[model samples]
Target chain A: MTLLESRSRTSRSSHGGTAEDSRPGDLCLVVMETPNAPHSEAQAAVSDPPADLSHRLSVLLESIGRGDQAAFAEFYQLTSRRVFGMARRVLIDPELSEDTTQEVFLQVWQNASKFDPKAGSPLSWLMTISHRRAVDRVRSSQSSTDREAKYGASTQDIDHDSVADQVGSRLEAEAVVRCLETLTETQQESVRLAYYGGLTYREVAERLNAAVPTIKSRIRDGLIRLKTCLGVS
Target chain B: MTETNSGRNGRSGSFGDTVAVDLASGRAVDLAELYALDALTDEERQAIEQYMSAAPAAERTEFFDRVRQARETLARTFRIEEQPPADLFDRIVAQLPVQGSGPDAGTPAPPASGHIAGGQFAPRQPASGQPAGAQPAGGDELAQARQRREERRRPGGTRRWLAGVAAAAAIALGGVGVGSYVADQNDPMNQVVRAGDLREASVDVAGGGTATLLISSSEDAAVVKMNGVPAPPAGKVYQMWLIPKDGSAPVSQGLMDEEALSKPAVVEGISSAAALGITVEPAGGSQSPTLPTVAAAPLGA
Candidate 1:
């Protein structure tokens, strides 16, 4: 649809002041390869994006708030893969993941009006909601019981190699994998189990045979190192 | 326990109440990392939320910024993206209410006269006498239900408003309230069912079941009592809507989740609504009434 092309120019000019100040290069590679790789025109906009893409998403959300179905379709096309991917990572069941994906998009449609750019970038807002919904589903009583039964039949150690295999061969994924290597063994395990495994810090501590505070500090320190290495801020 | 240093334990106490207090009091900024990772329980998250709410606005903003950055960075690590099923978008579209056109376009304007018709309330028997079953069999049932609504809304077959003392007398003679629970004075179900000007109507739900609406124009509310209504399809719920007489978008009344099925659900703000409609939606409901309502009853005035 022409929605993306028409809105991108308006949003670019409107967000010029903030766009000029932010670190445009920090997330450029990551954003480029993640969700928008399938669309050729989207790839062209990757050169100076961090704010450009975020502003475009914000504008799409605003359009969706006014019940513009075309804009909603465009937004879904742009972000559904990543949303579904996040749900797959946490829920692991194909059926559940598909259901969660539907729920997340429906939520985006219903709550588009509540989005505030001042709170966070549009991708960040979307990922946060996706992660929360997936995690919530994982923690629900029935699913957790099923997971526990499944886990009891498997090894307790975090499957680091499996995670590595799941990372695509793209530059961003490789970069994150490299940053993850920089953390100590304990930090890597703690962070991986808690984030991708959808386990609480207490559960991470239980799994690792470490004290709760030790697990907490490991996650905090590990994230700080990754944040710096990835140039997130 | 003996392997740890005494100093860390001494500072935070024995890992239960003291640590929770530390988190609630805003002393545990490091917990922001766990919060970002979605690694905290609901109680832990609530404590952090309490701390953030009390902190200065700038400090609060900074905390969220930190969480956002970490979360975004972690999100990038999810490199393998899977395109959702091809039919998923169509299914999502199915859940959105038809807006600004289509079936909603040809409805006549609401009557301008102020007062409602004083005719007797004629309780129509449900078309099918079968009990509400499990989930709806399939889309065929929904299509049939929509056809029934279309027939009812046809120009010449417009539903007439029926109300009178005789109808109120009939309701009074029907001994028990809709639910088995004792009707407390403050109960919403009691308030509407016991109102002086209450009107009642029942519509057979699509798959198999009945939904009865008890309306009180004086209270500007209605209570929906669902009987033998099939559970919504997996991962979905029945959402109620108030269809305005002016043909604008329908306003959502609320959702009837599985647990809510047996009980009477009170729907307020019915004064401007010309009809009540029920649609099966994704859990948590949709912003508008999804087309092809499972059932509908005119709130004629």
Candidate 2:
């Protein structure tokens, strides 16, 4: 089983508070809470107000820039899963994704001073770094063969259902799913394939059998629509 | 929109042909969405960057603001949080420079001190007369070329490598002379370092310092450079082995003493090696890697 599956299972069992010691109502409570409980402390933090979370991350980054290990650790705890999940989504190989995630955090620690809060939100900065690193790993020569095999094995549409299954519990993620539903089929596919598949616009166009300009405009239009729906400006 | 396009066209015509058309058609502004989505290739991104660089400061700020918002919105869609493996943080910690020993510790060093030329280890030359963090002649150009090449090979890899080297140099060199000691073209280490597909990884030694392994897949060789690493125990020496990916026997690369450790050790025939492992061995070396390696840097093949 995946580490996430094992973790959720452990969390479920722990929430049970000893099966033999629990009453039926307690069991029912555990059952009801299972789907709602944040998977970890980090996930719990995700429910914080977006502005507060972003501010906290920016503060942590400034501390980390001064070589604060504790701040670095806290930052890692708050952001690692998102970083790793993005890497895993793009790279598909857990080992490589893990390596990329490690590299991303190391970069965070070393170059936290480069984080310009004026340019973007802390989460956006972090995810930008994460996404670029993951895409680079996928495009690197070392993984080319693996990528070829992956491409051969799976040319189908992105499994949004599976993506939703993984992220469905989070409020922001649910809103994102709702917003994604507002996109046209082509726009959604183009954006998803380019962003998550780590495919370039040209590659996305090729994958969908569309023109490059069409794919580019679709991705751009789709993101614009998402920006509107998500109220990000 | 037409007025905006005509004004942009007057300025963008001098930038370049593709960029001129992109701006004239008002697609350059729309390309911000593609840029934010990372759907554009390097060339396309550069085109957009050129267009933005030519625009008025206020316009440029507005464009980037839009891009940032778009990226932020898209980033929120990736909410599937899977906990990274428990040991990953520890691994990152191990690579971090010790507190107060990093480049930011009250030193006004060049920001570029983080970058080390490929295969060019910081040669410990106290008498070389180059001050710590001094930029060599044409260093900026070389660094930019290296950065571009690195981005072409693997985006974001150069930054991470720079970070590693910065941390490693800070700890291993004690924050002194972190500038690249560029060797002449005739140097064998230079040849491998200059390879198009050069890659590197560094690991902390058991006692102190760091050992960096620079791998060139195109050259089928790797150069192992040791900095501030203590010599092996009396009657013992450090030996290198190529640990095969197939789970076969470790192949001996060579041995290094105090003097040899100061220089780069070029290990050829690393195409099949999963990692370069170093172990403490009797002076001449051992047939196989001794249990518990002193240091090992994965080739990431």
Which prediction has the highest lDDT against the true structure? 2
Residue A204's C-alpha lDDT in candidate 2?
78
TM-score of each: 0.50, 0.50
Predicted chain A of model 1: TM-score relative to the true chain A? Answer: 0.69
Place model 2 in a CAPRI quality band.
incorrect
Candidate 2 lDDT tens digits, A11-121:
222222211112111112232245555465334333323554577678878977876654665567557767877786778676888899988998898889999988888
Give per-residue CA lDDT, model 2, range B1-301, as digits (tens): 1111222334332222243456666556666777777766677778779888998887788789879988798777765444454346656766776444544332222222332223333322113323221222223343334334433664423232332222211111111111223444444455565576555455556665557666778888876777558888999999988999899999988788776776666788888988788899998989988888877766754
lDDT for B224 in candidate 1 is 76
Local distance difference test values of all predictions, in order: 0.59, 0.60
TM-score of chain B of each: 0.41, 0.45
Task: Give the clash count for each candidate.
Answer: 2, 0
Model 1, position B160: C-alpha lDDT score: 16
Compose the digit string of candidate 1's lDDT tens values, residues B1-301. 1323222324443233234755654445556678899998888898789878887887788678778778767765554344454345545655665433335211211122111212322222112321111012222342233224433653321221111100111111111233343445556655675565665554556665556577888988887767557789899999999999888999987787787776667788888898899999999899987878887876753
List TM-score (chain A only) for every prediction.
Answer: 0.69, 0.72
Q: Pairs clashing in candidate 1?
A: B119-B163, B132-B228
lDDT of 1 by residue, A1-233 (tens): 23244344322221221111111111233334445355544443442233556777898788777565545655675576677766766676656787888888888878888899887778778888888888888888344445544444332422222223221223445677788887888888788777666788888777777888778777777887887887777
